[model samples]
Target: MSSTLLEVTRAAHEEVERLERIIVKDLQNEPATNKDRLFQSHRVRNMIETIMSTTHKLVEIYEDKDSARKDEIAALGGQTATGTNVFSAFYDRLKEIREYHRRHPAARVVDANEEHEALLKEEPVIEFTGEEAFGKYLDMHELYNQFINSKFGVPIEYSAYLDVFSQPHSIPRKLKLTRQYREYMENLLEHLIYFFQRTEPLQDLDRIFSKVTAEFEEQWENDNVQGWEKDVKESGQLPPQHTVIDLDYYSTVEELMEVGPDKLKEALVALGLKSGGTLQQRAERLFLTKDTPLEKLDKKHFAKRSHGSEQNGGAPALKEVDNSKEIALMEAKMKKLCDLLSETIVQTKENVVKKQALTYDEMEAEREEEEMQADTESDDEEQQIYNPLKLPMGWDGKPIPYWLYKLHGLGQEFKCEICGNYSYWGRRAFERHFKEWRHQHGMRCLGIPNTKNFNEITSIEEAKELWKKIQERQGLNKWRPDLEEEYEDREGNIYNKKTYTDLQRQGLI
Candidate 1:
């Protein structure tokens, strides 16, 4: 239909242009005789006026049709006539309505019998004019202002109607200044304001919304905490205490119980526990301890005398008591320190549990548990000697081998020459030994930095080379200022040569 209208408009335009050309040509070709030229000129002017009137009418008609089409498309909830497939458009709308109904089933029914029944009372009709009309517009503006302010908890002005009024097409063709026309304009303005509000971008609104939401959330949390405390008091139950380690172990145990003995055995074996004997035995070995009374155990008794008397093979003598007050004070201080540490641990555990509750997800929980279990198993296996060449078939039908142990020469007797001839076997045992305080002390004794990278350099030659490279990189052989040059007048104050010289030249120095 639009295409047909466009074709008719094109034809009308062409006809108008043709008439204009003909009128121009006639005026140009007129005879030079005064009377004939005058008559022909008058005729050409009349033709030109008629063509102009016709073109204006055609344009008006085209504009009216275009506006009507735009209205029709808008009424049908379509953006463009050419782009809209009637069937598909209606189908999508229907689907959307169906989905809305599915989500909120109550909106499917319309209640028109009781509450929405025709009211016996007639609504008041108020007319505004002059100042009163202007006052009513102010009232409407105030209402819009209040609506935005109250809804968003922020002040926002409605100026979209101003733009609508500025548009030429917004005014009807047969516009009037009557009461009905004024009412129509008011309604149109109201609609425009609503449309703008509904379609406005929320980028500017985010900060205000976030602040309001945060305040509400904080209040909600406070309320929840109060309610929880109340419930706890009413129930006469203590609040639960939870730690990160406790939660992890609890989850692991729960999963193991759910998966049964077969999986439990597998988990234990993976943890480097002997998988021999029954599943019950493996479970006991992993989770239980032997019950023994203190009285039943073989205990060693120490004499109340000093060992020096025993070594001299002499009769035990009583030692003189000294510094009893100082000893008592030290003991009290130690006790207070222990108490503080325990309190700190409890608070830290509570904080961790609270944080975990906020961010925890069930899927992520499972994945974390798996990773933790793998790490635990790896740590356990890393302490034991294992042959990487003989790989065991994993539960997943893949080869589960200690490849790192073989690669790092951990299965054999390993020694770090830089660490002063210490032999280590097993992956973790060797790595840990290499990174120990004693090993670091040994490296320091050798006048080298105790970096972990040196642990990989097992041979003396490689260690020497690494130490030499480190020394060169650190510029240990570079020229440096003496103590006097580094520190001028101030005791225990060190500086670069230039800074020291500058300070020394100053009168204060």
Candidate 2:
């Protein structure tokens, strides 16, 4: 009896997964002194990888030839072996791509319908009604009131529409409250996904996340974890702090900010001020509130969640909206995309976030890629010899020219204080980094505007002084209505507002 092709494929896939796992988990790390085993894992892994690659290549070539032959036959008005219509199938597949994009508007379909110019030129049909599209906008007027109300004991911090979006399977079916004790920051991340997507902050965040991922992976490699992704969650907790930020302890807000955004935010939270903003904003908020009476500090920031009724005996405010199925379906797709984004935050053991395939078909294709190829690449990298100096890799996967590296001053490292002391390799990278997201982000946190005037001013103190001087100069130049503007009196005498008022009061006009 012969096994079906699908059954054979499934068996082969399972065997591949098992073999790869054993090679990685069992044999890969055997000590070099184990002469009995002779450390044959590398050789065994390489040999298996070669066989897999060759087999897959041969199979692909055969399939390609077979498909081309059938296409040729169909194009020449002949029948295919399996009675398949290749020409029709090709266009049908293209149409399927078009239809998929139409159904899932937010899936980020790129190079879409670009297989043919005529199809690409065709405008996509707009399905959402004008009223529906208009209605979809967030009602800020009502939303702020809901936030102020903090309805259903949900803390306002994690109650935003976008925050609700990223938590998975949260649309169309119906909304449900978990009511589990989360300190408004149940998750490590407190900001919106949009904030995390910002370049500078993302880079800053990447460092924090990279450290966390490394530690988790090390634990996983040691067989301390049962599943791969159970620990892929954010802590949202601030970095550890030593002391309370105080006016007596620190002379300037710049001095107070030496503790970093984490500490600054903690101080802001303690002071009952808005804790969200760049590092600079938090420090400023803390310093400004230092002299204020405790009662004057924002109470809204720490407002307790209300149940069915507000403490004032007012019922929770509601914004009534009539939803159409089309709008609901659109929202469902959007919610699914958001859910998938949070679901697919896997790290590749390197510090990089693994790029997720955007569509189901692409994801299926990615899953089908041979696992051995990755192992083979890793093995090949280990076996190859390289430069002793450990220079940067070039576009062709070799150490870049030593002179080119020297010319660019790549050997030297520059650290930007504004960028949380993130180091940039080479003078070009260092200079360029000042203008990039990380440095600019650091500046933004300090409440300093990123401009040429502040360029190369990485010292927080210097930035504060320059910002103060700029503000002073701006104030001097600013038009004062009472002093600067001249008013013509009935006697044809031009007088400033103060002079004109004095003359009118004295009856001297």
Candidate 3:
């Protein structure tokens, strides 16, 4: 569309030039002398012809200059009629600009206004030039970045960026968002891999980003997937990873009896065992599958068998399992593996569908269990939370170490009298609290403007006194022209304008 518009604009220029030439020719050939020949004088005709010729020359010159300009524009990639603003190269220029300035301390940085004025005067001036930060790399190569950005086609709107680059952690500019800019930190890291790929000098950085992003992906999976499996095992829903390490060893009746009742039931379900009764019954039910090695245990339940299952498919191979947790997490793992085997048994042996009715009591118990787990973790940090000052606990439900508390100046107390003697912990908090709701409310109650002058002044008396002094100063500084201006009498005695006026009216100087 822009190309079409540009072509039309070019053609319009040609048409206009052609029309102008035709109009000039018509005027010149119209003959200055009329049909009556009343103005047919040699000198007059010569004067009229000279004026028309000069006008024709001026028009030709304009056309030539315009053509030259068109060629220049075409050489630099023909002008696009659709361009609303200039595309600045931010990423390509900012680093170089900073480097140049840093290396050359004597180099003066010319601001935008100075550069504009110098250009207007056609004088040479060093101007700050940088390429605009356009996130084409993210929009193209990074899949997540591309996907998130595709949700909104508005890259920039209302004079603000509406894309991923406008997000909180955007490298270019981190400004308050006028619209929702949803994205994850890892996506930004992935996009940086290619962002630096374009920079020849930063090839090492390209490799670094690739390594970092890979590590991030692995860490995320470990945290989420493994954490979920651990939760399932803890809840007695599945057996732990290590216990399931050797499904064949636990197939015997003796091994089956070793697991607890709940685990035994779960094991029965996992091994495709459908029988249900006491703990011993569930165990005895699992013992029936002793001959069918863990490898072929599923064959009795299902007639069809895959070639791989018949060969190496005894169980799914786990990846990245930390086997070192075998001892400490044995009970959990035992329950986990048994539960998995139990599930396999029931699912394969029983055609009846299993249903789970929601248990509100169990949900409450689980919530309490999670809290208790956190409490247990806290206990590991210390036998008990010991703080004579009663410092606040961190998110982990344990008081922060004493050294850290002192480092943040949390040991020192600050009382804001204006805020009803509300206590604030640390200088930073004390400084910030002045602008917060409590302090603002206090200032409002005192009928004082929440100005910067009253920031450190917390006491009610001090604030009231300052307000009184401010009022007095303002009154003294108020515009009173009658008292401020002086009038000199004939005897050179000076009086205030108001008194002088009164005395003069009474004919007394």
Candidate 4:
């Protein structure tokens, strides 16, 4: 499509030049009538030149407008047509000009009427030397630099190589997406090299060139195979094969493509592989037979004959038996073995019978004995009921029956210092009473510190009152401090060697 358009554009230029030649010829053939004729000839030449220049300029502008329209459409998130107000204004102006011309008729004079004027005004001609033209193109070149910098994060000079050397001046028409885009990629390589020389890590530029060239070729071909614009519109993302690795891994073609043959070898070595044997070979050697080196048979088959052998067809092998005198010896051994077996059988039977019978006998004996013991205990308890000992301490220090003492395990020997007769229970009961009022008062009267008292508690209220008094008098607070600290310390020391040794010796620590 572009080639055809270029051909048409070239033909149009030729036709315009041909038409200019015909007009110049017609003007030159006119009768030369002194000053007027000379002036008319000059004007005709000027008009022809003006028309040619203006026509070319208009073509350039329209082409640029078309390109800008496409760009605007693309930039506005891909609408099909550009929605530029300039196009509407141009259309309205074109209509007005055509209407004015149609309404106001002029004399039919060939290249002589001043009223039928040329649409173009004379433009200032900038006479550019080679350097200036190069500079003009360089303006485009710099844009290429900016483009490469923006798109691929490369600098302009580095991206200028292609423009400077590969194909100078005549930028490829295919890449001329727009006037900007045409120069943009054309000078990409050169500008890229410019920036890379200063900012780049050490690398062979030629290798980078080769890789990039290959990439460009690939991308170009891909765009051809799958239309670049269509692919972008159809897919929200770039295609899978279009992926480029980041800077860190973009060292070589292989690395960029992730075809890590060298790395695979290194990985195999890291996996403890030495020889270049295939995985299948390794697995076969590890899991399969190990007979002869060639056959690699298993060891289990050595003790048994192989199947389908005539001599050992159905059965493998049977043990050999002796005859005559050896048989008589075997008979004697059998008799001894049978006798031992009989003894073992008898012992097993006896063990089972004993196990079963012993539990039944024990249960029966325990029942009879428990009944006798219960009767005996009842007789003894009745005797003790009438012969109760006197309790020295009671709730009010009155004499109490010894039965409570027997059950409570507290008597005169267990009397609290604070409340002497009040202590008549176990250690826990004594400790409870110690935290009571009577026990506190008795200890104080006896010149013994209240701390020495125990078992004077007759009620929960008395225990609380004594505890509060002790806390106030002795500055003691926090119950079970000793027990708590002992527990914490012992728990902390459990992992110590001495603690472990003591635990092992005592079967507990």
Candidate 5:
């Protein structure tokens, strides 16, 4: 037993090490800026810490049990627990090494270009042929691949999309566009499909449904017992009081057909949609029936059953006209909706392109100015003052610029006071940080009294003040109930209390 436990413990330790390698490699591509790097480091720390803690607990339990079992084994025979002792000793040393590594900071992380530069120094370059549009396709493919790769830690290679486009089903049929457009569309679809496949698993859907039911049952078992009992009493498991018909009779098509059209007509007559005229006259009346009720026959069911009436050879002309008009009206509404949606999409795309063009111009201008400054500085030794503007602090003797301090403050201003990180990427991140915090804290603090300018923070002082206020409000060290209550209110307002509260305090809520 001791030896078996030792082997299991060793295996678990090895497994965690393997998992850690994968996690670290995945995070290598993340940006190494103040907030982003801080966040990535924190995330990696959390993952490693979790792995370490779990490993520790498992080792501790195994050792305790193994020692007791060894004593039992000693009583039984002369054989010693060498394997158990060796594994325990090894795990202890490994844990100590890991702890030391945790205490000592690692080398600073660098950007993707820097990392790629280091890699490309040894590797030979490959060449490819391309048309004019091929460049655009390649660019789009690379961008899409990068986005997915960074996000999900999944490799969606350019070759994979090329393979997809080469498939007979896609190339000769649906995506029969120019080669460049086909490849681009394939790449886009590849990303969408990859994400969808990752999210949607192949396990029995009923199992998920069962788990949901089990969770609901577990949650409501104690607290809602009396209510549940009352509900069961009021609504018994037997057939509903309104369900008077025999279910067995309705189960088979043969049984329904055996009832005959005459019997069905008589049943409908009993329900008050009968005409004073004969069966032919009633069929004619029912054809045009819209608001008329046949108590047990739903209007939808009546319309469906009326399809059989067409074969019965009555009111064929009336039925054809009704179906045609309904189809025509539906087609007209669909066309109008399509036009409206297309117009909205065109305007939205125009706005986005305009905004992107302006941003690109600004970035280009800044780059040119930076290049000019760099050239001038290289020419003159006196003006060698490195503008450590957006650079990380503690790089050189040059003191950290005022803007970085301001940016850090702005990043903090938007970061979750509870989580100490940005909520998500893109839109959700913006909504949580800028709209939620800045709006609540007072728009004047962000210097955007009326406008929605979240990306731009006005000054270093305002940013610093906001950051300080957030810390105070969150009661990081100081336990202020008033501020805590404010956090609670904001959490509720955003419909995200669980996200706002830490895990330890989550149970209390």
Candidate 6:
């Protein structure tokens, strides 16, 4: 009985030693966060407590058995041995084991001073407050509203528009302008023009206004139009409409050149001229002489001019043409581009705000549901239950403490056969989790040392192959002088072979 008790105690001690080795190794190698260190410390403490309790019980049992045996020997007329108690040796061993643990504490369960230092090193989480979030949202909303109304001459209701924007599918659907509001504005413009025509003395006012409206409509059509109405109407099948440039306005080459390269290119391209060469080359080719007729210049003529220029080994020197009209046209185009860019920026900001508002709304709904569920649970006595292991939900509806996913192998896309088929979502997570404790444990269970490439192995066969290579390297290292040599000076400082050789050559050691 005494022998059996001793065996049990020894086995427990061995198990405790194994756990301690694992904990110490993890502490040395793993770059754990404060929370992770705390968890490891608690686990070690629990295991230690259980070992201590079991050893005490075993000692008690051994003492009782020893006492009974001594009594039986005395009753049988045999001289009772007065030597040292058998349980005393076990007690001494237990004390020594306890002392060893006391001297070498569990991983991250450091002395008070060390714990204080660790606490100081920990970073606090910064949470975004409701008031700050709402304030930012309101500011962005006002700016976006002002930009749209000022630029497009349309007013949007903030609350109503935000409701549509907050929908999860709204952004992908490309919800930009409201259809009813657009049609209303178009009709209003027409009504205003009619009213002005009846009230004013100008006879051709309506015709002038209609022409201006047509130009604006043409511009809108040519621009990259967003929203469902434009998409459903165009269907990406129709070719882009060309801008009609009345050639009658520009009677001379000088007047044509004043419109700038872009407008000049557009006019030439529309007129079926050869669309080759640089803007300057094309312009020079088309207007070779001041009296050259625009109708007379064709693709063949332009091609011939290009071939002639190439044969002559260089482009013909064209005269620099600059005018006030060209400068004015460039300025106008720049201003239009600026307006389009600003509108795009404003729309992008609006999308960001929509996303934020959607997240905020979802969080609020979740909070309310939790509160209601708590109330119902409180009303029921037997039915009320709590799960301490369940993690809290984040604002995005994911589990709080994101590392929990790694532990349970949840939300992962790839599974590794070597690590008990644990899943990893991305390459980063897969690589990072390989160095983690859970993965290392799996390797140990398979009787394989967790090498640098252990985490990278996807199958048991791969692990075995790597282990074989590692053993070969170890065997080679045993015979290698480079692996065995370590230099130490009189001050007991250790150095590698290269460093020691250099130091000795320099007489520094």
**What total of clashing residue pairs does each candidate reach?**
0, 7, 28, 31, 0, 0
The weakest ten consecutive residues by lDDT in model 5 span: 234-243
For candidate 4, the 10 contiguous residues with the lowest summed lDDT are 316-325
lDDT of 2 by residue, 1-509 (tens): 01223334455565565445544444444544422132243334443665586558546644766575345435444345667565775776567667877877888534423433332223322222332221122212233344334322244432243344333332211111112212222221332233233211213444544564565457545645221212211221122121245466777878978889987775665433577878877777777655655455555543253222246453332210122222232333333333434422221111121222245444433433333244345756655634556778878666665656667899898777777777889978877777788877888799988998987777788889999999999996898989978989887889999999898899988
lDDT: the better of candidates 2 and 3: 2
Q: How well is each residue in 353-413 modelled by candidate 4, as lDDT tens digits?
A: 5545676436544554555455556745434322123334457433444344445665434
TM-scores, all candidates, are: 0.17, 0.23, 0.20, 0.17, 0.20, 0.25
Indicate the residue-level lDDT of 16 in model 3: 48
- As for model 5, its CA RMSD to the true structure in angstroms is 37.3
lDDT of candidates 1 onward, in order: 0.45, 0.49, 0.49, 0.41, 0.42, 0.49
RMSD to truth, every model: 42.0, 30.1, 37.1, 44.2, 37.3, 43.1
User: Model 1 Cα displacement at 54 (Å)?
Assistant: 99
lDDT of 5 by residue, 383-502 (tens): 655543443334754434444434444323343332233343333444555555544354454443423432344344555576667667867577544334434442454324344465
At residue 359, candidate 5 shows an lDDT of 66
Off by over 4 Å in 4: 1-124, 127-131, 134-138, 156-241, 244-509
Root-mean-square deviation of Cα positions for candidate 3 versus the true structure, in angstroms? 37.1
At residue 356, what lDDT does model 3 achieve? 26
